[model samples]
Structures are given as C-alpha cells and as structure tokens.
Target: MTSSAGFTASLGRRRAYWQAGVCLAVLLGAVYLARSHWPALESGAGRLAVADQGWLLTGAVAAAGTWAASALAQQGAVVRRLPGARLTATQFAASAANHLLPAGLGAGAVNLRFLMRCGLPPGRAAGALAVKAASGAVVRLALLALLAPVCPGLLRLPRVSPLVVAAVLTAAGLAAVLLATPWWTRCRRALAAVLADIRALHARPARAAALWGGSVAFAALHALVLIAVTRAVGLPLAPLQVALLYLAASSAAALLPTPGGLGSLDAALAFALTAAGTPGAGAASAVLGYRLLTVWLPLLPGLLVLAVLVRRKAL
Candidate 1:
C-alpha cells in the first residue's frame, strides 16, 4: 500500500512537470503567433475611438474586473490562503502575458510559478489550475446553454458532412489508443492525485463557492464588457443578444488555438455580430471597441505590473 501511494505521488509530480513543459512550449508558439497576427488586428482597434465614452468606461471597468475575478477563482482553487493584493497583481501581469503570448501561455506560467512560490507542491499547484480551467469551461458552456433559448437562432450549429465527422472521430480514436496503451497505468496514477485534490476542494464549501462563483462571474463579466461596447457603438442587437453572441463567439474561438484567441476571436465576434443583424460597419466597430477595452487599454499597466511581480519574485 505504501509503495502504491508513493508511486501515485511521483506520477502526480510527473504530470505537473509535463503540464509546465507544455505551457512553456505553447508560450514560445504564442510569441511566434502573436507577432505574425498582430498587424492584422491592430488597424481595426482604433475605430473604437468613436464609441460612446460612458459605455466605453463601463466596458473598461468590466475588463479590469476580469482579473479580479481570475484572482478570486485562483484563491478558491486551493485550500491555502493566497495574499489577495499580490494575487490580483499577478493576475494583472498574467493577463498582459496572456495577451502578449496568447492562449494561456503567459498566464498559466505566471500562475503556476506563483503557486509554487506560495509553497504548493508542483503537482497540487498544477492540479489547482486544472480544476480552475475545468470549472471555467463548465461555466461558459452552462451560460451558453442557458442563453441560447432566449435568443432564438442567434447561435446555429454548422452542418458538418459525415466524412468530416468520421475523420475527426477516427483521429481521436487513434490518438487515444496511442496514448492509452502505453500510459494507462501512469495516467491513472496521475489522475488519482487530481481526483483526490478535487474531492478535498469540494469538501470545503467556501472554496467550492468561490471556485464556481468566480468562474461564472468571469464569463458573465466578459460578456458584459462586449455588451457595453456593442451598445456604445450603437449595435442594433439587444444586450442579452450581445451577451449570447459574445459567449458563442468566444466558445467557438477555443478551437483555433490562437494566442489570446486573437485573429479567430476577432473574426468570429465580428461575424457573429453581423450574422445577428448588426450592420457590417457596426460589427467592425463593436469588435474594435471590445478589443480596445479588454486588450489595448490595460496592456501596458499589466506588463508593468508583471515586471514588478517578477522583480519582487512574487511570480
């Protein structure tokens, strides 16, 4: 029994190390991807200048709140207490890093390092991130389902040919077989640690609340940011419709693997806006305004905060 337990713990460590390595690899790719795609999106963001100042400010506030929500979610993921101010600052920096790198490259590395600095075992730290990510995905999907009914036909599933579906299934099956055969034992060992961590987390009511609440707030707040921007630019869509559209666009953008979901998200959002009865020009401006509030505005300050945290070795 002792030997089995020891092996599980070691496998957990391996999984954490593996996760960290993947983050670093993606960070490098994010750098490459961000540079290539930056110029394409840069031009349209300036159009947000004409949006209503009041609505823009509201979106700006919502954008900032995303980081706080992230911090809260992070705090709730682990049993230990994290220093609130420092954690929020780290999230700010992480956001900048996420923007610069894309996906979660910058942000994941930042958070993972901070958790380690706070004395979490590498495995547990990595598990915490996994739990947070899983919760966020769940909340996003939940919101999407709930909002879909309110806005009829706002989000439509594209028709996929049977051949394409078959190909995807085949690919997935092959990959699963390739990994499952050799790594099944090790994978189970690692998953044991993850499941144990999750069980422990759920045992505490407060942490569970924070975990789910922060996740819900994070998604809702982002949608609110987009809604405010859309309204500011005089998009014809209702606020609820805008929220639904943003959720759908963002959910779809997850498939593209773009750093920070940049080109894909921008394109998807504008397309969604146009599809949902927004004029073409209005859609473009709305997308621009949303990006301005969420990305361009806070970028510098976030980077500076990131620098401060690194200098202080807080991340």
Candidate 2:
C-alpha cells in the first residue's frame, strides 16, 4: 500500500510538470503568431537582410551584459552573500520568465523564491526587491537629467491634449481612493520596512556602490543595445540622444502593466525613434533588431536554464 501511494504521488507531480510545459509552449506559439502578423515587425524582419551585421552583433553582446548587471544589483540588495554563478543564472532565467508573466511578475517571483531559499524572511525578501526597483528608477531618472542638457530637443514630451489632462486627473483620483483604503496603512508599513532595509544595506560602501553602479550599468547597457540597433539600421541619431530617448520611452511604457512591456514598450520605442527624426522604416527596423537581440535570442536558452534551475530546486 505504501509503495502504491508513493508511485501515485510521483505520477501526479510528473503530470503537473507536463501541464506547465504545455502552457508555456502555447504562450510562445501565440506570441510568435501575433508577431508574424504585426506589420511593423514584418517590415523590420525584412530590413534585417540589409542591416549591418557587425552592429547587430554588438547589440546582442550588450543585451547579454544587462543580465550580469542585474545579478550584481540583486546581490547588492541584501547583506547576505549569494552564490555568484547561481545568482547570474537566475537573472538570465528571470529575463525569460518575465515574458511569461505580466508586470514583472515572472522575474519578481523567481527572485523572491531565490531570496527565501537564501534564508531571508519573506518580508525582507520583498523589501530587497523594492529597494532594487527604487534604486533602478532613481538611477534612470538621474541619467535622464544629466543627458537632457547634452541632448537638446531629443526628449521632448508630446503636447498634452484635453484627453491627456483628463487621464492624469483620473489617475490621481484613483490613487487617492486607493490610499484611502484600509490596505493603505499596510502599504505604508511595507514601504517603511523597505526604507529601513535600504538604509541598512547601504551602510557598507561596497554594497552601496554595487547597488548604484550595477543599476546604472544595467540601464546604460539597454540603451547601448538600442543605439547599436539604430546604427545597424542606419539611423543618424547621436548615441546620447538615442539613450535619452530610450530612457523616456521606457519610463512612459512602464505605466502599462504588460508582461515584459511587450506591446507598449515596442510601440513607444518606435514612436520615440521616429520623433527623433529616424525614418519610419528605420525606426521599425531598429526596434525589431533590438527586440531580436534582447528578447527572442536569449528567450529559449533562458527558459532551458529556468527549467534546469527548477528541477534542481535552485529557485
């Protein structure tokens, strides 16, 4: 009887694994079909035949660098030392997982599990994630402020129409309502804990430096990839200008809660490039090249790593 029960439990676990694999396959298939029919993506794929291969390769290399930077930032968030190889691999896996879940949920879930496994309490693990996110946002804004003066007219916001004003007001109202809820106090307490964690983590100069430096490098690497893509497609924008545009467009797209910023980010990037005077076809090509390097190329390998880590119980 005991042996039969154990066999049945093992069979159930295998069935669950099969179900997850099928779901992931379905999701990837749907994304591929959607991209195939998207006109901009179609044009960009065609332009790839004529693009400079060297520049595209450079962009791909830069994409890889972002994963290392992310791992560094995550390590810096906590006082406990994490295994370097596993942490980096987790970041690589997280990048692929981000596409599978919405609003950063996939990566966040993976990292949270990692932190818990590292022996951090659940609340502290969450606080560490918050600190990393907050620090990253600050670094991006600081970079934008520094670059705006150098890249004049490159980060222009669109003229605010009545609809924009209404949207802003409605958002503000919603935020106020949210804050008035009973849950707001809990949120405030969570924020306070996160702030305390940040203070403690930053007390060590090395930790502070790693956190800030890794964040800046991570954002910069992303911009560099975009710049490389632009050059590959023969767009004439300066590097600083392209970087600034990337920051602005990415910030704007973060407002949307999509998985991996898929649709919103791509559209915002294409718009920003065109606004900065790149031809429409070139902008489309650039976005395509950038996505190809950052998303499509690493996706399969990242997922494979994710599967390995899961099977090993590393995440």
Per-prediction TM-score: 0.84, 0.86
Q: Write the per-residue lDDT of candidate 1 for residues 201-292, one digit (tens) a residue.
A: 89999999989999999998999999998878776788889988988899888765555776678778977987887766677778778887
* Winning candidate number (lDDT): 2
Tens digits of per-residue lDDT for model 2, 168-204: 9999999999899966897999999998888898798
TM-score of 2: 0.86
Evaluate candidate 1 by giving its C-alpha RMSD to the native, one decimal: 5.7
The C-alpha stretches of model 1 lying farther than 4 A from their native spots are 1-47
Residue 62 in candidate 1, Cα distance off native in Å: 0.6
- Per model, state how many residue pairs clash: 4, 0
Task: Give the clashing pairs for model 1.
Answer: 102-259, 102-260, 103-259, 103-260
C-alpha-based local distance difference test score of model 1: 0.83
The per-model lDDT (C-alpha) reads 0.83, 0.86
- Per-prediction RMSD in angstroms? 5.7, 7.5
